[model samples]
Target chain A: MGNNPHDAGLTEGPAPMDEQLVAYLDGELDDESSRRLEQQLASDSTLRDQLSRLERTWDALDELERIEVDQEFTRTTIEMVALAAEREHQEEERRRPARRRRQWLLGLAAIVLACFAGFAGTWYFLPDPNRQLIEDLPVLQRLDEYQLIDTIEFLKLLRDRQLFPAKTEDASTVREASPVVAAGPSAVNREVGAGVAGKREYEKNRARIEAMAPGDKRQLSDNWRRFDKLSDEKQEELRNLHGALQLEGDREELERVMEAYCEWASDKLSAPELSHLDRLLPAERIEQVAAYKASPRRQFGRRDGFWDMARNPYGTRWFGRGVSGSSVKEYADALKTWAGRYVADRAEVLAELLPREEGTKWKAGLAKAPADDPEQVKSRWIYLVRWYLAGPKQDMPIDGEDVASLEALLSPNARKFFEQIPPEAKKREIPVGLRRMIGFHFQTGQPEFENLIAAEDLDRFRKTLSVDMEENLRKFPSAEKQNEWVRFAYFQSKLPRDARSSRDDRHSPGSARPPYGPPSHDGPSGPRRGPGGEPREPGDGPRGMRPGPAGIPPPPADQPAEKR
Target chain B: MLEVRDDNAATFEELMLRYQNRVITFLEHHTGNHELAKDLAQDVFMRVWRARKDYVPGAKFSTWLFTITSNVAKNAQRSRSRRHEVNLEGRDSGPLGVRPLEAMAQVSSGQIPARALDRAEVRDVVWMAVQSLNERQRAAVLLSKFEGMSYAEIAETMGMSVQAIKSLLSRARTNLREVLEPYFDFGSPPETSDDADSS
Candidate 1:
């Protein structure tokens, strides 16, 4: 073996002969190399013997069994890929909101800069006196109202009195408007013009002041200067009181309440009683006010006037009768009943609108509610709706039908805009999509949905409705309902020209014709027509009239027929 | 592969079907364990799936796949070495650091009766001979022989230069010849200890 060429070659580091022979066997060598190796192999018996052994060993590896994975392996591999895809999709979904928030922040920054530029331009042109007035505009606008209420504590007491009647606006609307107020501590630093919406309101007020007569301007300026004279803490308290009143709806009602409280406090309370009232906490002050009303010592011949002033300042009854304990319970009960009925009527629609898991949870909650106790059921439903709505909007379940209807309603440009959204987001329910579209439409004014209705038809629709779109939005009982109606109107607006013309031709002289088409009398509970056969106001359109194909009513299950 | 990169499941399944057996056979020969080869083959395909998104369509898809296979096999070997667990199917060590095949060779060469070996026994002898090579040598030889990969393709898959692959295959073939020549020349089992001693 030592004398053999193969044994000598193997003893050395990779011999060229061994590499050539292995490459030749593996067909890795070029033809020239193979020929060279073959010549060497024929001439050298040892090299030929070495090549044969390599070939035999390579061939012996063929005895290793062929591996065939079962169908289960293929199935599992596919499942693993699918699971990975879903995880990636969910990760993308998780990242989407942060991206959207960045976009929203960019948009908000642009708006803020534009507003700042406008304000800077105004300030640059304004005289010193007018500039000071502009600086104090928020406080000046409510100067008389704040003047009547000396302290925030007194304002809190008056609020506790329930003297200001709650506005008829829906609770959801108020909640949507005052997020800072609902969030508590953050609301403290959020002055009147701190945010985008507040800035717009501030700009509107500024324009109103700019247009004011000289006498009115002078009066407001004097009020501002007087407000400026107050100590810093007092000024902050007054500003906070104004903010609190603003956060509550109906500032005019609050002003009346302030006036009544001021008049009643000065007349009814002795000096020490007034001092005592001021020292007490809010709840204690409320109790003290009730005590003063009941006390014979302070009871003058105007006891009836005291009761009238304290309980019902404005002759009309409010949600609760008075600040009395029983009346507070009544108010709570009334609010619950209203919320419960609202939720119960729209339960199915709301359920469909929630995410699958949340919808299931909501249904389970409703199922578990005490059937014998209606109040408990209503409270349970309210809790479920609130909990579900408080979560992220991306988690909201979208009804495919609603998305389809909303897409159909979009104008050509709007449809293009909708198509530009990711496919993953296109299936989102109407409220989110409609709100986005409406925001975009207003921001850009590109007639995204405007062209769906002709000018004359839109004018007719607006005149017949007797309110602008903003007021129409306010009239909806819930945010979801508002979106639903907007979606419905848009859908109706896109009806074919021939269809509308033929429907108008068939319309009787006394019958109301909606701008989309003639009202569908075939469906039960079709929209109510006005006296002169005009379309009823938008919010007044029958709650049951869900927009279906060609403005027909959807199935009964989808229709929340009960009034909000 | 491009279709797989675009998240087409059917194309991925088809690719798996076309390559699964070959991958498993290569891993089995590389690892010398059937069950582990099946498991590692799945891991190789999973790596393929994960890497699909970043897969550039330049190299042959098989080259990319076998590259993943080589890494996975190397990692499995490294971990098994760390665990200090002897791979019983491909046991290279016997008494006194001598391989079991060397002992069998000695036994067959001695007066110990040489029984008529069946096809399974020949396969086992061949498996022990292949396993007697070092990890890189085993991979190079198995890929070149069973996978029918060229030296350049094997180098690409193993992340080595072609010259290195040529040298590797030369040394691997020499080792295999040393281990399998006795069994090929005579009816005796191969000597697995001499290659270990030489390396």
Candidate 2:
């Protein structure tokens, strides 16, 4: 989400801060921060003049507070009027199905057309699944050169025989899972767990994000402190020149502060550079430095703190906001392009009897997705992600997409997968296009059975299924995954366990955290239609309508309308 | 008889009700206009509503609410100035602290009237002073002078190092002093120091 952060803290360059003035005004020093400000006020006419103006503005603003309302108004006056309007509109939703159907058709068609404006109206997309997640291609090549098909065979055998050779370190050390301990009637059971080191990384980043802005506050105090420190005569001289150099976002304002400081320092230390030093530092950097310098001592350091060299996303290696690097931009643009596809890339094919212009109308047709509401937004995003993941719905907005745009859109989810992908499969992201081979990453057959499963995948999963599962379990061996794996092995174990073993230990140990949840690209294709709206014609001018973004399933697939 | 943190929603709602009118009044005073004040006040509640999900019981909620409100008011001021967001370096408060918005998509079709200054002065000179502050300094001043928060409380709410809080409050005061030098000098209270202060 961020870029290289060299001088990131200096977003506006260093501006000016009158430290003496700040110290004098706040009286935070041993004599109170304002002691310094009072001292400077005696000598600095210009700084004193600026203070006087601020005092007047505050007075005028204070009078602005006299406006009053009727007692204890729990709700706004406008809500009553809005509520009436809302009622009137809700009644209309009952009678608009026919009109909506037509509109939906037109909208879907239009959206599909808009998406394919680049592809000359060809609705088909053939995203080389390999090309989509090429963040680490060498890893893919390494998997190709070693351990592709035989691994899956071993996995199946392991599961089939229930041969669970859990490492001794893992067997006893696997943390036990506890059920939610209800605390109240309608109990909202909350678990405030600091997630493993990974989630902690995110939390740290988020906190740092929260703290960064207020740094600007100290800039003012620093300037005030500087101003308060000045000789009375010097303060008067600086203030007379119009003490306008006190804004937070602009650092050049510091030049004036620096000028005053310079003039005063020149008198005090006789260093000529003291005057122009503000010019060299710049307003933005000065603001950053002044802001950081003015703040109190930090207790947290790089070791156990928010941002250290190891994980600070805004480290010097990263490019700052401007045009600093090309490779990063290329990656960023690729990411954005992928993110865009997730929003609206898939198509919905309606009956040929349906019109073509309103394919994407379903999006806007969404029951009033008002921008101001977050609950509505959160609900919508969840719905969208689910609908895409679940499958192409007959009622969903598949009316106008050509396959290519759908491919472009669907690719982002794959990229998201890349973002959250486990390291074991990290090596198999890229496909080596040698001999037009298909390398699908499904099925765990024997080493010789690798040829039996002629994959269209680079076989990333097949290459490291056991190893990755073991690692993931090692990270967080939750009872859910373990139990799921146990249940699955019990069903698949087919072996008659010694015909007399203990009833509880019927199924011998198998791998914990079985790979049960992969998006099913299997089974017969769902109902399909082309531009001509032919009923059940799969892959004609374009491929079948796939789920738009990430085909994530909704929490309750049975009742899609009911939120989880 | 009861652990107060049990129903945070009730507590938070109580906190909101207790401070809602006070905050609106503060905004009106700060902006010198009631309508803008109301809008900012509404925005403040919207934040208090969302921040509920992140609420931790051990900490005081008022401090958190004040921080959120101060950030929202300042951000609203910036967006009103010119829609392009140069997001504040610190993220103590702001709606987008949740996630980045499609800020570039919405273009201003000139909602603010272009009124020429009566005398060769700047527009919304008060806003210029506020907008000039870094995010934290502005929030600190808003909480202290406008929201009437004590320094130690502000530190807890802001989650800053006290020295940092001191610098922030001091800088804010200095800026206010520089801007309102012509006004009254009724030195309200002594500087807040943690060594001798408690709830």
Candidate 3:
């Protein structure tokens, strides 16, 4: 009759006498039945084992029923609960914003609203909490980063339209096809206009010696100025004389000497002579001297040999035509140099990431807890973390055992550092405080982030970053820029409440936002390419008709300190 | 990466504060040490918070939440280091060495201790056996033995599926067997000895 078995049809072996034991122990069993079991158990080892198991089960139940927690643990976790509430409370209060329509009315607006409500019976509608956050009732822009960006943008726009002519996007295009490089005129050019021999004598003497050097066109513009300055009588006399013996009025002897000297000169200097023949020769039925410089052997127009030396730089640069082998190789070498910088650092972000995700969530709550519920809620906590001071002690190389052990102790947490990180990338969590500035989840190969950093001007821009954010920006710059773009990231991550924007700016010398060391350098260094590597001219985007400034030179990329 | 949205953390904390005192009382009773009990209570809160990100709303909140609480406390107690340590030093204080349970007795059975157990020896013996059980064994005993949790409900709170929890309770009983063997022979058989040993 007592061929009792393991829980009938159960996979595991052996049925526990646990239920009966509890009933028997609690005296819930009827006296006759309890007595029968007591009689059987007196000598039965198997039944006794079952009984023992049941009795211990009862013992544990009793013990667990009566245990309590430590006073400190309860108080501490409770305090954390209160903190989150307090912060949220303060934030909600601070986040209150005003209506623009109300602002438009100003002193009269409130009255107008009242009047409209009274007369038209305009029952104003308010949106749901989520919808209110969505609607542009008032931005969170009244304070912190948003406010600062708003002002800066306003000033920038004002300056772009008012102070500067607004450098056109095509201005760079004008660089290559350089207009005549008219500089401040030389004194000789002036003296020549005054028709003085003072400069001409100097040119004639220089030209005599220069004429001896083969193919040399040294100081052509200079000589031309001096020659123009020489008194017309000296010029006319020289023009009439023997060597100046107007070879059909090739009149300028200096011109002949300079051209003859070009053939023997080491290398050409000035460009070939220009076709301003009308000035050199009279509109005469005159003879030409092909070999005027060498009695019967040479030509006398300004030497046309130094063509390469006097090549047009603007044309070369604009057309990309004049690529001297030397400089072209320099650019190629530089490209190689840049490629070498692509190294993979060994440091990982897992340690920073996982704990924050797990710890903060754990710190915050129990399942089914309401946002404002103070009691009856199971407030989560980073208990082992708090006990062991887990956040700071975590190192990248910790063993999985330690990792799992630590994890087994705590719970999930809030988006601390990398709030912008997508769900999938946040494999491990970071601590709340460090997480704020650290959790951007861009993978190494993302093109959007890469292209932005690859722009020519990124190097220049990187040089300007603040130290706090620079190291972060280095491994991940474009995202950092995006972090900057949403003006609130710094304010969000850096714990704005604890370190309020310094009202006195820098009353605390050793503080995070200390007295100014240097100005923030990231105002865009000229224009840069977009995520697609397309050149993003500043002013052309959605913001306005103009872009960021051209001359505000971005800081260097190497300096980690200024990145933030 | 446990992604606890900031909003979720706030929600979780609210959950903790709501249930903390009761859960602490439960943990204290189970662990027999207020400090360990509190620590276990915190674990329950943290576990629920961590796990709740995926919590679907179909189940009763208390059921789901308590399920986690009970599971965490049991697991903590069953951990290798804690395996041998029993909750012998119950922290709940009251007249007659049972304040919390006395309150429970008032709520459940409604019978004063005097009416239920006139003999002090029986109560002492009952408590002595209870102190010998391990964590899950104790929880199984309490929930089933005292609080009257179904195998299924006990399974949910302890994070085990029903079958697994059942097996666990069975193992817990086996553990309880050893502690109860001598006690039972000493306590219950005496009443029946008049029929046998006396004969």
Best by DockQ: 1
Interface C-alpha root-mean-square deviation, candidates in order? 45.3, 24.4, 40.3
CAPRI-style grade of the A/B interface in model 2: incorrect
Per-residue lDDT tens digits for candidate 1, residues A226-272, read 56546678776766675676666654455556645654554334322
For model 1, the superposed segments whose C-alpha errors exceed 4 Å read A9-12, A97-564, B89-117, B191-199
List model 2 lDDT by residue over A380-464, tens digit each: 3322322322222222232223223322332232334333435432222211100001100001111221232123322432343
Sorted into a CAPRI-style docking class, model 1 comes out as incorrect
Lowest lDDT block of 10, candidate 3 chain A: A306-315
Q: What would the per-residue lDDT of candidate 1 be over residues B64-182, giving only the tens digit for each residue?
A: 88899989999998887787544433222211111222222222232111111122344555776777677898888778766778888999899899988888888887767665554
Q: Chain A only: TM-score of every candidate?
A: 0.23, 0.17, 0.14
lDDT of 2 by residue, B100-191 (tens): 01010010111111110100011122333454455566566666655556667778767777656766654554444333221111101111
Fnat of model 3, as a fraction: 0.09
Determine the TM-score of chain B of model 3: 0.52
Alpha-carbon runs more than 4 Å astray in model 3: A1-77, A85-564, B1-22, B46-54, B78-131, B174-178, B184-199
Model 1, global lDDT: 0.51
TM-score of 2: 0.24
For candidate 1 chain B, the 10 contiguous residues with the lowest summed lDDT are B92-101
Model 3: per-residue Cα lDDT over A13-129, one tens digit each: 334454454445545567997997798778777666555444443443332222223335545664544454445444554555645434433433333333333322312243232
Better of 1 and 2 by TM-score: 1
